[model samples]
Target: MRTQVAIIGAGPAGLFLAHLLARAGVDAVVLERRTRDYVEGRVRAGVLEQGTVALMERLGLDARLRAEGLVHTGTNLAYDGEIFRIDMAALTGGSAVTVYGQQEVMRDLFDAAESRGVRIVFEAEDLRLDGLTGDRPSVAFTRNGVAQSLACDFVAACDGFHGVGRASIPADVLKVYERVYPFGWLGILAEVPPVNHELIYANHAHGFALASMRSPTRSRYYVQVGLDERIEDWSDERFWDEVETRLGPQASAGLVRGPSFEKSIAPLRSFVAEPMRYGRLFLAGDAAHIVPPTGAKGMNLAVSDVAMLAEALTLHYAERDASGLDGYSARALARVWKAERFSWWFTGLTHRFPDMDAFARRMQVAELAYIRGSKAAQTAIAENYVGLPMGFGGEPSNR
Candidate 1:
């Protein structure tokens, strides 16, 4: 098979890229190592930045998102038993975030792409890229135990952190910056109304807790846990107790307890790979960078990455231009590092460190107090939460 682009992974980044390329009349093929069901069911982040929402609308793939997504103008930050609300819309010039699951976004992208007859091959195995430095690149893979080769003008490595995309690049050519947190989040999805209407990030003496929701009736919550803690160690009742204790009295009063259907612990980490391009191969989303879930920037970052990439590729094929493609790495990384800083800062603010001394804890309290008392601090928080403009300066022109 020959195409203009060979995309690996069926996640949001890969699928969105394929859809964008299709609309631009660029022939591209997507290869997924998992089935469609598996791709659509993977539970991930649920917050969409304003720019992401706009991009989805521009693509005409947000009918369901517009109807079902919870539009939040603000988010709550709790510390010292007091809740501080940052008016995201007010502080960010009427910008707001949409509470929509990453999986749901993938589903929407998949439907939009499939209806347009974009080529997507599932259950692909042993995917490999070759000749990325040359004028042409090819992806070798297997489907149903049969060998296959896809020749393309370029390759997109959206296969994620553990996938072959970043690994394919020689280590010497890449500079990696990473920091793994000392703890993890024990998250649960339950069938109950959320503790509050908007997402809440709570800081308590014990740990950090978050109250968020997927929909009106389905809630997603998380409590900080030790790195050694296992899902099997906490029962439903115990988890609820931990949540209530950490969220303080006001926010926990409305908490509804129910049997959780999904429980898992995710370790926190901040990571970024410099120059998100390698010859003819470009990496977007998790394949290029990762941020801790504190700022809810992971999926949104992926959206922006592809938005820029798609625009660049569209220009290349449509107008015979190469400037956008040439600058993709610098443009994308400039925003990536800002997100990393925000996620790291927010994580430190809300999470209790294992080695936190009295002075450190006091600093945490003082910082939150300053944010709560100062409009400037709140505005900064709100700006990052609602998301910076696509390029961190002006609105992205992709849409």
Candidate 2:
């Protein structure tokens, strides 16, 4: 097979890139190692930044999102038994976030792309890219126990964190930065209703806990702890008690225990790779960078990378202008680093450290108090939470 672009991985980044490139008159093929059902059903980030929603709306992918997603004006910061609501819209000039699962967004993108005749090969394995010379690069893979090869003008590595894209790059040409937190989040999705109207980030001496919901009828919650904790070790009774204790009495008021749909532990980390592009291959999404879920920027950042990648490819194919393609790394990294900083900041604020002495704990409490008391501090949090603006580097949206 031959195409204008060979997009590896059928996740949001690759799917959205193929869709956008198709609309731009570019032929693109997507490959996924997982089945369609698995990719569309995997649970992931649920918060969509304002810019993300706007981009989806423009692409005509917002119909189902608008119908099913919930919009939140702000989030609550609870610490020291006090609750403070930071009005995101008020602080960010009417900007707000939508609660829509990444899986759902992927489903919408996948359906739209398929309906439009975009090629997506699923259940394929051993995909490899080689021979970067000439106009068409070589993509080798196996489908249904049969080997095949694809040649494309450009290759997009949107596979994921453990994907081959990063590994393909020469070690000397890359600089990797990473921070693995001592704890991971024990996440659970319950069939019961949510305990709060909006997402809440709770800080306590025990650890950090997040109160978020998937929908009106489903609640998603998390607690910070060691990554080695097994799901079998946590009983239903202990889980609710830990949630109730950390979330305090308010959470207890509306708490309803139900069957847990998904329960897993996710480690916290911040990782970035310099110069996200190499030769004829461009990396996007988790293939390029990773942010802790604290700021909910992982999926959004991936989508944003592909959005820019799509535009860059369009310019390269249509106008013969390499400016956009040349600037892709710098442009994407500007936003990536900012998000990394914000995620780290939020993670540090909420997570308890083994070395957190009495002085450090008091400082954290003081910082929380100042954020609650000062409009400026609240605005800062609101801006990062809602989203930073699109294009290169800019201030977080104040509207």
Candidate 3:
């Protein structure tokens, strides 16, 4: 197979990149190691930054999202049973986030791309990029026990953190910055109704708990705990009780138990890779950077990376210009680092450290109090929450 772009991985980043490139009259092929059903059903981030939603709308991929997504004007920050709502729209000039699962977004994009005749190969394994500096970079992979090669002008490594894309880069040329938190989130998806109108980020003595809803009929919640905790150790009753204790005393407005749909743990961390590109192969999304889920920036950042990449590739192919391509790494890393900082700030303020001394705990509380009391602090939080501007701060003209 031959194309202008060979996109590895069919996750949101890869799929969206292919879609955007196709609309720009670029031919691209996407390869995924997982089945279509698995990719579309995997649970991940749910919040969409305002810029992401706007980009989707411009790309004509927002019909279902607009109909099915739940929009929130603000989110509640709860501590010691007191709640403070940071009005995102008020602070960010009417820009607000929409609560829609990452899996759902993937489903929408995959379906739309397929309907538009985009090529996507699933269950393909052993993806390897070879001869990236040559005229035609080749992607070697196996599909249904048969090895095949895909020739392309360039390769976009949208495969995630554990994928081969990140490993393909030589270690000497890469500078990895990472910090893993001592705690991880024990996330659960329940069939019951949500406990609150909007997301409730609670900070309590026991730990941190997030009360978020996927839809009107489904609730998604998380509790901070040791990374090694087993799901079997916490019964349904115990989980609900812990949630109530952290959120507040049990009441009608409190969370009610329901059939658990999914339970898993995700370790919290902040990571970034300098210069998201090397030679003819470029890394985007989780392959380039990762952010803790506290600020709900992981999926959004991935989308942002691909959005920029698609534009860059379009410019390169349309105008025979390498300027956008040359500056792609720097432009993408700027937003990536900003998101990393924001996620780190939010995680540090909310999650308690095991070895935190009395003075440190007091300082954390004081910081939270200051954020609630100071309009400037709240505006800063709200601005990051809504999203930063897109398109590298210039007109959409090709660079």
Candidate 4:
């Protein structure tokens, strides 16, 4: 098969790009190693930054999102169970975040792709990219034990961190920066009303805990755990007890406990691959960077990567301009690094370090107290929470 762009992976990054290209009259095909059911079934982050919400509307896929998404104008932070609110919408000129699950976003993208005639190849195994350094590039993969080849003008590597896209870059040409945290988050999804109308991030002597939701009826919560912690040791009763203790009585007063349907532990990390473009291939989403979920920047970061990337590709096709493509790496990395810093900072503020001395604990308390009393501090937090303008400063603002 021949096309203008060969997109690897059918995740949010890849699927979003395919839809954008289709609208711009660019021909592309998406290849996924797993079935659509498997891809959509994976439980992931549930918060959407305004840019992501805007992208959905621009693609004409926001009908369900607008109708069902729970909007939060503010978020809460707790220092030893004394919670303080950060009015994100009021502080950021009416900017707010939508609580919509990443899985739902993928489902909507998939359904629209099928109806809009965006092509996606599922169960495509062993993807390989060739001639990325040359003028033209081609992708090869096997499906159902049969080999296939696709010729394309460019290759988009949205396959993820373990995929062949970033790995295809020469080691000497790629420089990586990463920091793995000493703790992981033990997260659970339960069928119950959330304790509060807005999400809460708590800092306790015990650990860090987050109370969030997928919808009003489905609640998602997480508490920090040591690296050696095991899922088997955490029962529903024990988990709820930890939450109640950490959240303090004020916020936990209305807390409801129920049987958890999904539970897992995920390690946190901050990672980035310098120069997102290597020849004809471009990296977006997890392939290029990862942020700790502390700031809820993982999925939102991926969306912004593609939003900037899609605009670049659109410019190349529509106006015969290569500047956007040439500068894609620098432009996207600028935004990616800011998110990394925020996630790292937020994690440090809320999580108890294995090596945190009393001095460090006091400093955290002092900082939270300062933020509570200072409008300037709250504004900074609110703007970052709502998401920085797609263009950090000098880049184009993506709609």
Candidate 5:
């Protein structure tokens, strides 16, 4: 097989890039190590930034999202049993996030790919990149135990952090920065109405807890736990009890308890692999960076990365201009770092630290109190929560 671009991974980044490139009249093929069912069924984040929604519309894949997505104009913060709402839409000039699951987004992307003429090769295993530094590059992989090769002009590595994409980058050229938090979030999916209309992030003496929903009938909630925690130890009853306690009285009002259908523990961390672009290989999404879920920036960050990557690749193909491609790394990293900071800050504010002294706890409370009382502070949180403008490198947005 041969194409202008060989995209590795069928995740949001790769699929989004495929759609963007196809719309630009560029020929590309996506390769995934897993089947479409597995990719679409994977449980992931549910928050969608406005830019992500815009891209879905730009790619003509928003019909289902528009119909099923729950839009939130505001989000709530709770500490010391008192809850306050942040008017995100009012603060950001009418920008708000959509509570659409990553699974739904993947389904939409896959459903439209064939009609839109984007090709994807699933179960492509042992993928290898050859001649990345040279103008002529190719990918070698296996499908059904048969060896195959795809020669392409460029490679987009969106296969995620554990995949071969980032590993292919030379050690000397890649620099990694990572912070693994001491705690993890034990979350559950229950078929019950959400306690509140808007999502809530609660900080208590116990830990951090979040109240969220996948739909009007499905609730998604999380409570902070130690890294040593185990899933078997957290029964459905125990989870409900703990989450409600951390949420406190006000936020936990009307909290409904039911049998949890899905439960898992997710570790928190902030990781960034610098120089997102090396030779003809550009890493996107979790392949390049990871933000703690505190600010709900994971998938949104991936969409933004691929948007920039798509623009760079489109410019390269459309105008024979290499400026965008040349500036891709610095440009994408500009936004990546800002998100990293916001996620880190938000995590610190709402999560209990193992080493937190009394003064530190008081400081966290003081900050939250300040944000509650001061419009300026609330404005800052609201803007970051809705996602900063798609302004890369501080110039005007072409998006």
Candidate 6:
């Protein structure tokens, strides 16, 4: 097979990149190691930053999202048995977030890609990239016992953190930075109306809890747990009890309890592999960086990364210009680091550290109080929560 670009992984990053490349008249093919069902059913982040929503709308993939997604102008922060609201829209001049599942986003992108005749090969195995430093790179994989080789001008590594993308790069060329937290989040999706109209982040002495929704009828909630915690030890009844206790009586009012249809424990980490591009191979989304879900920036960061990647690729093909492609790493990394900062900061503020001393706890309380009381502090929170403007190396946004 031959194409202008060979995209690895069919997750949001690769799929969106293919969609953008096609619209730009660049040919590309996507390869996924899992079946289509598995890819679309993976439950992940649900919050959509303002820029993410706008990008989907531009791609004509927001028909279902705009209809079904829950919009929030503000979010609540609970600590010391009290709830304080941050008016995101008011603070950020009408910027807000949308509650839309990552599964739904993939479904939409998949549907759009299929309808438009973009090639996606699922169930690919042992996917490998070759000659990334050369002008022409290629992807090799096996599908149903048949060996296939795809030649392309560029290779996009959107295969995620554990995928072959980063492993393919030489250790001497890639510098890795990672921080694995001592905790994880035990999350569940239940078929019940959400307890509140907006999302809430609670700071309890026990741990951190989050009250969020996938839709009006399907509530998604999470509580911080030790890294050693196991999902099998948690029962539906116990999960509900813990969630309610952490949220407090007032916030848990009208809390509807139901068996969770899906449950999982996700470890928290902040990881970034510097210089997202090496030769003709470019890493997008989770393949390049990861942030704790506290800031809700995982998928949003991926969308922004690919948007920059797509822009660079488009310029390369349309005008025979390689400037954007050359600067892709610096441009994408600029935004990736900012998101890491926000997620790290928010995680520290909300989560109870098991090893934290009295002084550290006191600082957490004081910071929460300051954010609740000060307009400037609230603005900083709202702006970062809703997302900062897309800036490429301090250049003014043309959007």
What are the per-residue Cα lDDT tens digits for candidate 3 across 124-219? Answer: 899889987667789999999999999989999999999888788888988999999999998899999898878988888888999998899899
Q: Candidate 1 clash total?
A: 0
Question: In lDDT terms, how accurate is model 5?
Answer: 0.93
For candidate 5, lDDT tens digit of each residue in 39-87?
9999899999988998899888999889999999999999998899999
Q: Lowest-lDDT window of 10 residues in candidate 4?
A: 390-399
Q: In model 3, what is the error at residue 142, expressed in angstroms? A: 0.8
Off by over 4 Å in 1: 392-399
Worst 10 residues of 3 by lDDT: 390-399
Per residue, candidate 4 scores C-alpha lDDT tens digits across 1-399 of 999999999999999999988988888999999999999998988989988888899899999999999999999998776888999988989999999999999999999897787999999999899999998799999999999999998999998888899999999999999999999999999999999999999999999999999888889999999999999999999999999998888878889999999999999999999889999999999999999999789888888888888888888999999998998899888889888989999999999999999999999999999999999999988888888778622445442
Q: Which ten-residue region of model 1 has the weakest summed lDDT?
A: 390-399
lDDT of each: 0.91, 0.87, 0.86, 0.91, 0.93, 0.92
**Number of clashes in every candidate structure?**
0, 4, 0, 0, 0, 0
List the pairs of residues colliding in candidate 5. none
Model 6 residue runs over 4 Å out of place are 392-399
Residue 109 accuracy (lDDT) in model 3? 91
Among these predictions, the greatest lDDT belongs to 5
Query: Can you tell me which runs of candidate 2 are displaced by over 4 Å?
Result: 392-399
**Candidate 4 TM-score to native:** 0.98
Q: TM-score for model 2?
A: 0.97
**TM-score versus the correct structure, for each prediction:** 0.98, 0.97, 0.97, 0.98, 0.98, 0.98
